[model samples]
Target: MINNSKILLVYTGGTIGMIKDFETGALRPFNFDELLQSIPELKLLDHEIETVSFENPIDSSNMNPEYYLKIAEIIEESYETYDGFVILHGSDTMSYSSSALSFMFENLNKPIIFTGSQLPIGDLRTDAKENLITSIQLAGLKKNGKNVLSEVGLYFEYKLYRANRTTKINAEHFQAFSSLNYPALAESGVHLDINEAMIKKANRRKKLIVHKELDNNIMVLKLFPGINENIINQLISAKGLKGIVLETYGSGNACNEDWFINLLDKAIKNGILIVNVTQCIGGSVVMGHYATSTRLEEIGVISGKDITTESAVAKMMYLLPKELSSKVFKTIFETSLRGEML
Candidate 1:
């Protein structure tokens, strides 16, 4: 058992690490080594800190599965040395990246908290410092001599949420993230009060497992009222498409037309996994609750049960390579692998 908490800060680039040029007033990358220098308050935190940076930090729009593997490998390599980890990432794809990491590691016994700011750390009223500082505090949290957060989480705007349950909901607001279907695991108040009951405690008896095989041959098809068969067929039959996150109508409803059902059924029979997620930000996909969605349930569509689009993509990428049978794939997709869904 580790007695002391040590945190490793992983920087993967984002607005949090950017600074505006005094002359041109344009944003540019700042040296991550200066992180502590920028936030001297970090020296006041309880835990010892170490930092690492990617060779090249790209914008979150450039984030992909390869980067996800690199992040996972870094944590795996330092797993034993560090008590917990905090990843500084771009808020644009933070949810997707964080959610992917949640699935990559099984039986994680420490906090891997992801945080970033809507404004640059150098800004007058930036959210970066507080987010980073408090995330470290949460990472170092222990109870009865055991780690508190033994799961991946996204900490932003004073709330720490299950990573897989988060979504980047706003671009201009300091509160850019939201975990609608789930309660926050911890909230940073004057006292840093944690929701003890909401934390996911891991069984330390189990060894950590890292999964690297993420297959990205999947697509998300958002349903619209007038979506035509031609576009549906084109999307379903895309070359090398292995799975589809069908963003269905409310309550998992879809067009009751024969062509739509036939198109999806044929795709399913062709070894394609189709998972149903509601387009709404809130609410679960209760397929048979409505008459329009009954055929979706009958046709073997897997319910996503209120998972965010980012998480559904991450889950698909992680699970597509396992080559589970179509039935097994459906069963597992409906089940919550991480705390991604209800």
Candidate 2:
């Protein structure tokens, strides 16, 4: 006997939560309590929908670790009661928020799908309706009487991707995100086609654990022509800075200049962790592959492999506060813990 699944809809603020004011012709947040009134198609699904929204909605730019903790707390409080979760978020930084949540929840066994739209739900041609309707349907899918998607993921533009692997690529296009080094977990057309082989399998016996503590003392350094030592020193020398995401050239190459090496070396000696992530969108960072990168390898820079910037940031936040030794940090950063890297 198949029982109807209960899905929790968490609206964390985005175009999907907005509506156009008739007189002002401007967009404003909609009351999700009236969800069925706006998208009645939801009533046709075979699942029960419950909603929770932020007391005061926040834009994607304002999203932070505090919000991530709040979201995790909600899921933790209702974990056993719900079969799955669907998060409505702003598109601009949805990838970052989703990536952070991926790390926050360990040993997850239920689907937590994050999605949003490029246009407000109230718009006549809004993408929100289809996105919301499909996301709910995806959340309720089951295999062998258990939730089908057992990991964190992002559903957008007709494709579902591993949340930690995705990066938003456009602001104007309806198809706004891409998983550079990974394939879509599912696709929606006339019928939803799930790539079962690509879905992550969870450990059924391990209890879900939510990690709320995240360290925000991290920086991102991008290498470019004419970037002076003074600028580098200013950023690397900041007070209490603990981690850095170094966006290097192709294959993780960077200027082999003495001053640059000296600066990085000094930071490493002071216990600051530096991760070498490639600036290229579609390739992995292969440290020591070339003479130029061998110097970075010598100074304890950890290669991020094929991890995206969003995942790198989230990983640093999750790992930095654990007080792991520099050696341990290097090992963990290089090791693919959640399928975020190659």
Candidate 3:
């Protein structure tokens, strides 16, 4: 392996790599050959840089586990040669993609930083340059002759957050992502400020294990005040469903109805793993905290703690293939396989 720091820039197509078509007033993908030509400042960083562009870039909305696996494949294939990776992605599903990657790469020891712009790079006032440049700097960052930020992260609006902890909170703002329950891994200002104390330091001794078996045979059941039995029963009875992310109210609270409880209880007994995640953004799921949630707890609904819905779905997809027993599955789901929850 090469000793010097080498950062691989992977462009899978996003607003950050687009240029405007003045004639049509539309955005177009910029070529990889023009990457360095567009950003000469990259030459100033004290690290070797390489670029890899997908044949046809995907919009973030079109993102799925297949693409997630493809990203994991890219990182695995280049893991030895590159010191770190910077993924250019669209903001719309950036959190979902980043979260999936976090679970996909086990024992990761290099930064896989995802970043993109709300505005196209060709725009005069674009945020793409700043986000991309700083992300590269972060990917190349080292301390005591070892990599810094050895985990999946999303860098936007000057903050680098744990990938699984983030959620896309807005569409029109430069600061589009938020990790409410987790502090940023790093912040960029006049200088890079990595909160070393909170960093999930890598156990470099273990080999990286890339998991590609993702099962999307799951559904998200978000509860509201007037949600009825017809809707709940139909979903709980999904023909091939393997799991359900029950987006409950505060502290994993759900409706206190006999029919709802019966539907969920039957689903769990029939091998559907139900994970009870709070719909609120910033709190943990205290399963039996109130009478409303107590029924869910008694019915063996898995508590998602403080895990975000994005991460919850990713976790279910990643873990369900193991086919652990009902009790074992619930135990593992409550545990922090990745640092996705408290």
Highest lDDT model number: 2
Question: Residue by residue across 243-333, what tens digits does model 3's lDDT show?
Answer: 9999999888898889889989989899999999988888889988899999988989999999999999999999998889989989998
Candidate 3: minimum summed lDDT over ten consecutive residues — where? 1-10
Local distance difference test, per candidate? 0.89, 0.92, 0.90
Candidate 2 deviant stretches above 4 angstroms:
1-3
The residue-level lDDT of candidate 1 at 286 comes to 94
Model 1 lDDT tens row, 1-342:
233579999989999878878789898887777777777888777578888988888799999999999999999999999889999999999999999999999989989999999888878888888998988888877777878789999999999999999888899998999888999998888777678798787888999999999999999999888999999899889999999998987788889899999999999989888889988887889989998888988888888988988899999999889889988888888888887987
Q: What's the lDDT for candidate 1?
A: 0.89
Ranking by TM-score: 2, 3, 1
Question: Which residue pairs collide in model 2, if any?
Answer: none
Residue 280 shift from truth in candidate 1, angstroms: 0.8
RMSD of each: 1.7, 1.2, 1.9
The top-ranked prediction according to TM-score is 2
Report the error of model 1 at residue 87, Å: 0.6
TM-score of candidate 2 on Cα atoms, chains taken together = 0.98
lDDT of 2 by residue, 1-342 (tens): 233689999999988899999799998889988888778888888789999999988999999999999999999999999999999999999989999999999999999999999999999889999899888888888877988889899999899999999989999999999997999999999989899999999899998888888999999999999999999999999999999999999999999999999999999999899999988877899999999999999999999999998899999999997899999999998998777987
Poorly placed runs, candidate 1 (over 4 Å): 1-4
| Winner of 2 and 3 under lDDT | 2
Query: What TM-score would you give candidate 1 relative to the actual structure?
Result: 0.97
Which candidate would rank higher by lDDT, 1 or 2? 2
lDDT over C-alpha atoms for residue 66 of model 1: 97
